[model samples]
Target: MTESLDDTALDRLFRTARTRNGWTDRPVAEALLRQVYDLAKMGPTSANVSPARFVFVASAAAKARLAPHLSNTNRPKALAAPVCAIVAFDLDFAQRIPELFPNNPGAQAWFADPKVAEVTAFRNGSLQGAYLMLAARALGLDCGPMSGFSQSGLDAEFFAGTSWRSNFLCSLGYGSDENLFPRNPRLAFEDACRVL
Candidate 1:
């Protein structure tokens, strides 16, 4: 892990990785999904508060459960993919502090306040979501992460009676080049960063 990655690996992970809008007929296996989660869970979080939870909607029935909550533009993208992951955060994540941060006996109490828990969960969970995408890419998978979905509807359909709340949705599979638009411009480092 200490070695620098080759150009090919870097391009696959970031440089040339596009936000897929379409997928091929190829399927993503369950074992590969487990590998993605195993790699992603290694990403660090505040106080080791690993709040993210994922639901890999791989079956047609499961996708059907998720489709109605997606925006019209996103519905087809998700339905066509081999798998759609519901990236979520658990509001009650602090309860696992004893296990995740064994050295900090009071770690759980640190997030005792509802507001603190909510913020920490959301921030760290979002980081985990990004890590998931990169992990998938590292394993030669394509990603199409989208925010165009009904949060409340998704939560009700998938997370009701649970502490989990949807953060975003990402479809995964072999991407198709069909309908791919030209690469968009990105802000230069000088414009997006600071030297302070």
Candidate 2:
């Protein structure tokens, strides 16, 4: 049986983790980015339809391309961070089911409908995005995840002619306390969950 994570690990991953609103000048390396993906990819998804695709905006030119797509409130956060990751979902994810779920040869047929494929891709991709954030935090990086951008604009700018569709953006780097707001309260377990 797997052992429970210690309190320190839990605190780092969830309890005390904050949504970074400001960033320092530290640069996130390519190797670290690869490591983050490697860990996040291990998270489970339905039928193993791993549809999430990440575009790391690390270079000045790429950040420039991303800036216009962000809202005014989010622009500075994205620009200030060392990397802004565009988390996307691939519409053609089902095509790879034969490779991803070899034991279930018929799994690919389940997503033949456009609607089913779209929903599965989006739902699983969002799960992967959350895994990505957790992995980043595990690697000692802070995250500022946002959905304030125009989806059509981001898709047009970053995913034209591709099956990938933008889901959200996450800025990654060392966080600064400059713009941090007081931590808000979460719903109690009884309020948000049930044993039945």
Candidate 3:
């Protein structure tokens, strides 16, 4: 019997989702990472271009390679986490747009221009990355998404010889409540939203 998600589950997964920094020594299994990716891929993208590419860094050597690229504030937490996902975008995403946007004629050409390619890749890739985080949370993992790293350094060390470019990095693991900051306030709907 399949049980429907209740409000408690929804609140835990969405309303209470926070950017966790501290982590326990527990490991994240490869199978769980695969499950997260599978769920995240179902999220929609513009033209279904699906520009995001993930490099899951789990091995000790891979983490070593990533260390020098991170800012001091992010390094310790990243090292303690069980895995780090290098979320990237392929510059040649247009090659797949024809298959993704079958009925839209000349859709692939929209990303042929360098500027257009950059915009599409970053925007869609970031959206996919967000889905990745939610999916991870649903799968009982905590995430620390950070952009305080050196993208160029990561590209040179990890993404060399590929069309993929580093967009951001996310540390994944079981979070420790000990280091968590108090939840901050959010703008009320009336203050932040505008009616059309």
TM-score for candidate 2:
0.98
Candidate 3 residue-wise lDDT at 64: 98
Give the alpha carbon lDDT tens digit for every residue of 1-196 in model 3: 5987898778768788788888888999999999999999999999899999999998999999999999999998888899999999999999987788889948998877899998999999999999999899998998999999998999999988989999999999899885799999999999999999
Q: Give the per-residue Cα lDDT of candidate 2 at 69.
A: 85
Stretches of model 2 off by over 4 angstroms after superposition? none
Runs with alpha carbons beyond 4 Å of true place in candidate 3: 1-5
Which candidate has the highest lDDT of all? Answer: 1
**For candidate 1, what is the TM-score?**
0.97
Q: How do the residues 106-158 of candidate 1 rate in per-residue lDDT, one tens digit apiece?
A: 88999989999999999999999999999999999999999999999999999
- For residue 44, give model 1's deviation from the true position in Å: 0.8
Which parts of model 1 are misplaced by more than 4 Å? 1-3
Cα lDDT for residue 26, candidate 3: 93
lDDT of all predictions, in order shown? 0.95, 0.94, 0.91
